[model samples]
Target: MANDPIQQFEISKILPLEALGTDISFTNSSLFMVLTVGVSAAFLIMTTSGRGLIPSRLQSISEMCYEFVADLLRSSAGSEGMKFFPLVFSLFVFILMANLFGMFPYFFTVTSHIIVTAALALLVIGLVLVYGFWKNGFGFLKLFVPSGVPAVLIPLIVLIEVMSFISRPISLSVRLFANVLAGHITLKVFAGFIPMLSKLGFVGVVGALLPLGFTVALTALEFLVAFLQAYVFAILTCMYLNDAIHPSH
Candidate 1:
């Protein structure tokens, strides 16, 4: 059971709650979320708390994180998008940590779950919609209709645009969820082969190296996927926000 990677995703209540339906649940996924947030927060805060005239090693790491996210936001969303720094930064760090945390011996990866990813995706999408409407009011509807479309083409164009707009959250959620889920599953299948391979003695050891090496290589690849998945999520969010800020024809 300890060797089973999927067991990491199991949910268990740490403190039973009859009130809000959840009381200190210590689910694997929940634990991972808490761990990711706690670790990420500590990493950032401790790194930057020094505020040195000349940054020390930790300070340099902190500055790099800031510059990395700042550059990402500046390039993807521009200066007007600067106000969303906290949200964007949090999203990237949280997802990155979640993906990385699962690589540990007994930690769950919340990002692997569709529900968790969907909730985050919806949160971003919801915010984009709220901000868009607040900023543009009914003019937001203009996003669905091309500025120069002939009357005959307006309906078809608006229909397609509306469908695409509605699908944003689904696409965003699935991309992260699917990637992490598949990667973890593949890791598990390879790891499971060890027991069977071990029973064969000498040849078993030799055969076992196949899965062992694959796991090692895949683990490295997973790290890259972790970063890429986070980047993809953030960039897509920025693109959606851009559309909201300036609805295209």
Candidate 2:
């Protein structure tokens, strides 16, 4: 029924197509992803297309978002990290737009999927590795070795650092996927309660009010979470980039 929480997460093919023995069909997730990127791009362009000494509301919102991510990168990775503004800004805008789009009824949440989140996290880590090696050469190996450790503990510390480094993508992906998945599921559950409670006449209708209120409150909170998750992801990306830019401490 409409109350089934997991039903919201179902990925259905929109235009079934296969190539090279693989299911390369277009899907609802793909649709929303396109929509997310398109809408986000348009919003930025429309808002900032015309410059003004005194900004309009839309321009102000766009500038705020730009500064927010820029400040975050500058603070976390230093002014040297400004070179990565395009990457970090793109990630933040994509995630924030995808999440907000998912908030609408009948929309698919892309970031709620582990595969999508994992891909994004892997991209960040992969870039870090490539840049770190390219910029620092073999000296990037110092990232796993602290300067002050004793010879005896160096081996053990290096082992721990290696493990932690390997786990970055896993942790980053799971953090985003889990939060989005759990929040949506919880929202659905509470929302489902309203219809069920309303089936029992007067008392049922009154009880349904509670769930309705909760649903509204949860929806509001989810909006905040959507922005926050994007912010956290961007900031974390900056920190990882910092490691790449200055690998040795």
Candidate 3:
């Protein structure tokens, strides 16, 4: 058993599969990913399956999710971005589930890994770039060019804009990874102290209660962070999608 907080993230294979020349094995991370997807799918399906005139509690919750995403898209990206509701909604649910799933005991927090988040960030940036170019062609170049800059400063402005654009994926990925990693590590460290203090008799037991209390508080905060990170990711994705729609900005 590893006492190190970071080492706990390792995902070992639960059930190995060897087929068709490819090592399509299933690891803990893979299992969690499947679980997240399944949970999300079942949630949406069950909530929406009975769409009645008098909505049930589950139906209301589903409708709330739909309208929530709809409002976000409409407000952030406007009418043109409505077509991308599915993509944005899916991103929200997936990231939300990923973050929540990682909070479970004995589960690997995939979102805690930069590679997983970075890949998702890259996908968003890639979509923005591809759509921007496809929609506006050379006009998309305007994103890097400001209208009010002096001729001598045009090069510098464009360079800065380009750098910021390039850094989007890194920033997006790091934000989620750092939050989840820090929260989990904090929880683990506090948990470790509880057992260590258990041997100290009454005084130590009393002292351990403080950390236990803090850990409980922090757990609630982590849940908020999970949803907040998901919303931030989706919002920033929408903002970037806005650039695709109106590249002149």
Best by TM-score: 2
The Cα error of candidate 1 at residue 240, in Å, is 1.2
lDDT of 2 by residue, 189-214 (tens): 99999989999999999999999999
lDDT of 3 by residue, 151-245 (tens): 99999999999999999999999998899999999988887788889789999999999889988998899999999999999999999999999
**lDDT of each prediction vs. the true structure?**
0.84, 0.93, 0.89
Give the candidate order by descending lDDT: 2, 3, 1
TM-score of 3: 0.95
Estimate the overall C-alpha local distance difference test score of candidate 2. 0.93
- Residue-level lDDT of model 1, residues 1-249, one tens digit each, is 656767656677665446566455555566668889998899889877878899999889878877888888888778888888899889988998898887885667889889989999999999889998999999989989888889999889989998998998999999999999888888887887887798899999899999999988988988899989998998888777776777654
Question: What TM-score would each prediction reach against the true structure?
Answer: 0.92, 0.96, 0.95
Candidate that beats the other on lDDT, 1 or 3, i.e. the better one: 3
Worst ten-residue run, lDDT, model 3?
1-10
Give the distance in Å from residue 232's predicted Cα in candidate 1 to where it truly belongs. Answer: 0.8
